[model samples]
Target: MAASKIPGWVTAELFEDLLKANVEGFSKVKSFKADSGSAAGENYATIMLRVNIEVELQGKSRGRSSRIKSDFPPLDGKSKPVSYMVKLPHQLEMFQEMMKRTNIFDIERTMYNQVVPEIEAIYEEVGVDITFGARSYDLKNAKTDYVALEDLGVKGFKNANRLEGFDQAHTERVLQKLAQWHAASAVRVTTKGSYTDILLDGLYKEENRPMMTEMMKGIGSNFVKSCPTYEGYEVFIDKVKALQPVLIDKMFDFAKVDPMEFNVLNHGDSWSNNIMFQYDAFGKIKEVYLVDYQLPKYGTVAQDLLYFLISSTKLEDKLSKFDYYIKVYHENLVEHLKILKYSKPIPSLRDIHLALFKYGFFGYTVATGVMAAVLLDPTDTASFENFVGDTEAGLAFQMQLFNSPRFRKHIQVIMPWLLNRGALDM
Candidate 1:
């Protein structure tokens, strides 16, 4: 866990090039400094930077500072925010070892620089002024990948508390934006076919399957273990086990669908923490920006929606407003597509219900596993490597998190409905 003196996931040459090329100023490089990033909410593989520069133009010189985001760092989990399994050093080792062979950094870089611009353009043609992701500059994906991004905090955008998720209004605003994003992607797909293939390249390569499987198993076990009050527990367990072998396929199958099914480029990792919002004069959400694109997947649009709903919305609000939220998303999507002159069948309200029913396991797994990461209290959390190296203690620490009463309520609300609807039937 030795700290490197290197400033960040960046190089000096690219840093200066960025200033000259993207920064709107007559500038000479002065200094670049890496700000200590917060491990509280940031993932491993993220770094923050501030650039000090002298702006000289028209015989005037002034000093200015620019904020930069470094999304790709050394694969070692030490520098990244991987407190999740870092205590169990072997898990971190396993993840780091596997990542070396994958092109995850390249995936994200391509997403921001290439894919999103196209998604936005589709919306623009139809007269809907839309944007995907936050403002960023000097995007690059190389041996050391980094980007100089707009300092969103300075721009008045702030993240929702990871622990306190979206209420109804918050969910509606986000779903509207999500619809705009997905509608654009569908339009792009209708006219263009090549990018989806690049996004799908070896997405579930054999080398990575085992890790995903293990994680799903833990999620399933944790949910069943935590929720002791749910009726028909034995039935749920049997169906979950029956679904296990096929669940991975179903999950990845979301990326490849029948042409008739409505599909889009998924935010892939959409949740509260990755999204930031700005408020209007009345303190209502005016705009939202999706940040991470590291795990972009082309899938059934509901796959992305369900992941965010499961991971970001409070269980009580989601359960009660399920139909209403789905309708809201469908309406926004239909309007955008209509304006774009797309006639292909959009997902109906019925289609949405079916998708949610079919992908119920997807939501459950995310709720029990990834959602725990979303709601984790950074204050009491740790990856003190040595202590977590103890097998029993590390596992207990993970289980203790999702074993709370609230999580149990989430499981109860989620699992029973799926069972009653026969959603888990193979």
Candidate 2:
């Protein structure tokens, strides 16, 4: 847990600065220990730090030193080792090029920096309590790209089981919070003006088009091949294959506009893994936090809703509670928007239904791959450094995903459903 064990991306000086910025009344930092249980997320390396400090002032009133315990009870600062996540700019030159081109790190930086303040402002205006991703350091013009966010785990927010997805109760909690954020979009435009300078979200970014095209090429090829033969679904298979060449392009187009309303900035990756929830004193779920803003896209809220349902909820839960989830989201949107003083007409339940249907492609196009990643055993997963070591290795890693039983089970239901809904069609 020594500071030397910290990742190379974040230097000791930088971590100290972040600690002082977030932690209060600590004049001299005595010792900092890294948490041993940290793991590397797909795009970032997450290490934790336990920081201790001495409240020594430079020229304060002749302070007595010995046995001077304060009555504040240590300021109650014990949270499961504040996580420090550093963006992984892959060591491989080619992959680094892709990383920069896709702006994986940059998008998150933008979200934490520019967009989150706007989000917080709207939340404050609406008088609600919410938490974004970990608190970031030098977020506006961050050099190495790191964030010191509160670990929701410390706050009792636990991850949903990726293999099983979440039930309606958990999904309901997430949806309600999502509506609040989405409704705030209406307020943001009015107050914050615009954000033309920052990098656009993934689906809107020109640079990401090529990378997504490449990734989708692999995902789509395997998806089509997963379906051996269906008596009446060959046309859907052909459609899916045809999409191989332009699936990425089509995704961008599908999300370009909402027929009923303007697009809200969505948590583009809202799978079960990206959300955390906590229970109330009564042991019922009461709070939700959406993590990982790397792919925050400006689009229909239904886009986020459907993606969450498809990838994060079990089939039966989705079938049973799909309509009810939408209703909760709609109600929250209407109520929170009223709180925000939004002038635009909130989309009704019927409009939201149609919106979800229209945005089904957003879910179907990426759900299989997302679900595959969710099901992957961490032991079998490759680190970003090793995964992008070579083109063949990268392709091999993808093939492993395509062949996994978890991925296979997911596509069995997803592929056929997308076909039935014509969500895969251009």
Q: Against the hidden reference, what TM-scores do the models get?
A: 0.79, 0.81
Query: What local distance difference test score does each model get?
Result: 0.62, 0.63
lDDT of 1 by residue, 332-420 (tens): 98888777777578777888777776666566557666676666666334343211233565466567656655555566677776677
lDDT tens digits by residue: candidate 2, 327-374: 888898888888888877767889888877776777675665666666
Q: Which stretches of candidate 2 lie over 4 Å from their true place?
A: 1-11, 24-27, 35-85, 139-143, 197-203, 229-235, 258-260, 280-283, 382-392
- lDDT for model 1, please: 0.62
Please estimate how well model 2 matches the true structure, expressed as its whole-model Cα lDDT.
Answer: 0.63
